[model samples]
Target: MDTQADRLAGAATGCPYPFHRPAPLEQPKELADLRAEPVVKVLLPSGDQAWMVTRYADVRALLADPRISRNLNRPGAARISKTNKLFQDPRMDPDPPEHTRIRRLVMKALTATRVERMRPRVQQIADELVADLVRQGPPADLNETLAYPLPIRVVCELLGVPVQDQQRFRVWTSSFKSISGSSEQNRLALDNYMRELIETKRKSPADDLISAMIAARDEDDGRLSEYELHWWSRLLVLVGYETTAVQIGGAIAMMLAHPDQFALVQEDPDLMKSAVEEILRWKLVGSSVTMLRYVTEDVEVGGVTIPAGSSIIPAADSANQDESVFEHPEVFDVTRKDNIHLTFSAGTHFCAGAALGRVELEVVLATLLRELPNLRLTVPVERIRRDEKHLLESFLEIPVTW
Candidate 1:
């Protein structure tokens, strides 16, 4: 296709930074608009009219619709510029054929078995972080101490990157995550870091991701180029922690606030799986952006017509809250059945790190409850500050005390 439709160009009135916050967790303004009209055509800043499908059923159908393309490389693509900060990803820019290749390469390392095997290590990391928290006492910053660091540490291990350089790694990630930095500068900083790291890993074999990538590159040609390997490692590190950084805090916040649910998870560790799913659902993430989709053709959707060349947002957060598909969608019940929440998304583009994320959340959050049996927020629930302005919505500082 010569043209790429940008969703950012469409006509719609929603939160500009939907990834951060919107009309509270249980209530999204779009839900009501959707009920009134399953597909609402709205104008975007770029002057394009796009369809915003709100119903759970409709959203899922649209996501699975083969006509809904994810390629962002089209001529008119609605680029989520790094400055946008609306998404932790801009790599969503590639159209299929090209996109499929990068995605397949990513699938190699972010495999289900690798994530599953790392559970024990993740569990240990969680314990170690919390142990330090205990030493520091209540009124602790979970965001700085746990939410952010845990994922960084895990990804570092997965990439075979050294943890001894924790300060540098933290600074690297912080720059990318910074709301104030220029996108080019952050990208440059990240590129430089990855290049240096890759060179180091190449010269001397290590036990982390870079070393593994080098081995994998040698084994498979055209799969990972030197530049691709560099970017891949950087992308892994960046995407690896973006959502998870929020989830780590969001998971604990969801459970702690819902004592009954938290108690159940604490009592039966097996329930950790369900608890994590529920957390993924209830997370107050994604108010403005979603897994962006481009229409490959004109498709009739839920009594509405979506024309070809249109860009769309697969609002997983809204999809997760659809009451028709989910009974009591607003309730924070961990026992919800047959939950196939699309938080990690569905279809061919399903999150490569879905399994890894699940293991990390389950092991870490479960351990927190078990070790700090009396854990409670040091600050008022309502008073807790969330980075509602960024793509990853999370507590800026979840102060906790036991």
Candidate 2:
């Protein structure tokens, strides 16, 4: 078996194909070039060779293949960084019966019907945030004013987290997402906090997702273990807000950057449905791959054989931009029909909160456009700063004036 370093040395002689995950708004040229290859060998931050599957068909196939497992604890699993190994979620890593059991327990709280029931509340939260932004006058940071707060408030309410404690949770969660030195430390702190919250829910259950999970029983009349409860709660609270927040920010930034499309949606509210879908398609919120899936057996993908235990990353960004699947893939057309983007990922690991995230985006975008029809960026697009440390790509601050 060739080591990742040996494979890299033997395969390509030139400088390792530079795989810089693009910034939030920037198109990833390196990924586009990688898509042309049968299978691109790229070095991870961990200095391990992982296959980057960039084509739409290949990524989809890779995701659906049972031979590829998301469990990072497996030997030879591809990791993004050393710190990432410290923060694995059981809900995300397990395969089959175990994963199925965990997903079923959690899905009871996040079903489409339950999420749709929260739509009015989501809209109310969005309206309030937009109203506050308007009251604050022009030159407001939408990222802070709307993007961050709306999702945070909604998720907290749904999870029974005290809205007053949001600021503290925000700080801890920010550190959890950071690529900085303190990320692990913050992750541990968040874990401890969630543990305490779980205990609280156990003793005094409320009508929230956490409490619902606390009382939920399986078909066999089994309850979630303490460990399962802790990790799932943490995953719910962190991902519940983090991903949706980024999408909201990305959608707004993309729309404001392209005023023509923005005006089109603003003129007719009915287009909001397509606009939301296109925004999800066009935006690159998450990483090139959500998590590294290790091959459990020899698997052929994209005309290349991935050996057992080798790590492979499915490039969702490249898949979204695949020419075969999307026409004029570069253009952010709101009217795209049959738009199928991998932003929320695909297959069994597809985001459980996707439906909720969509509703949140729809409400927020429609509310913002209606309330602030004249919204425009205060600074040049190039001047916008992005958080380089976090795994997800998004503007740190989006100052806009209406």
Query: Which of the numbered candidates is closest to the native, going by highest TM-score?
Result: 2
Write one digit per residue (lDDT tens) for candidate 1, span 224-322: 667667767876787777668877877777677788888887778888788788888764554434466678888876776777787776667667777
lDDT of 2 by residue, 258-327 (tens): 8999999988888888899888886557566455678899988756788898888887777888999999
Angstrom error at residue 67, model 2: 0.2
Clash pairs detected, candidate 2: none
Q: How far is candidate 1 from the true structure (C-alpha RMSD, Å)?
A: 5.1
Off by over 4 Å in 1: 1-29, 42-49, 85-93, 175-183, 217-222
Candidate 1: Cα lDDT at 115: 75
Model 2 RMSD, rounded to 1 decimal: 3.5
Give lDDT for model 2.
0.77
Candidate 2 segments exceeding 4 Å error: 1-24, 86-93, 180-185
Candidate with top lDDT is 2
TM-score of 1: 0.86
- Candidate 1 lDDT at 122 equals 89
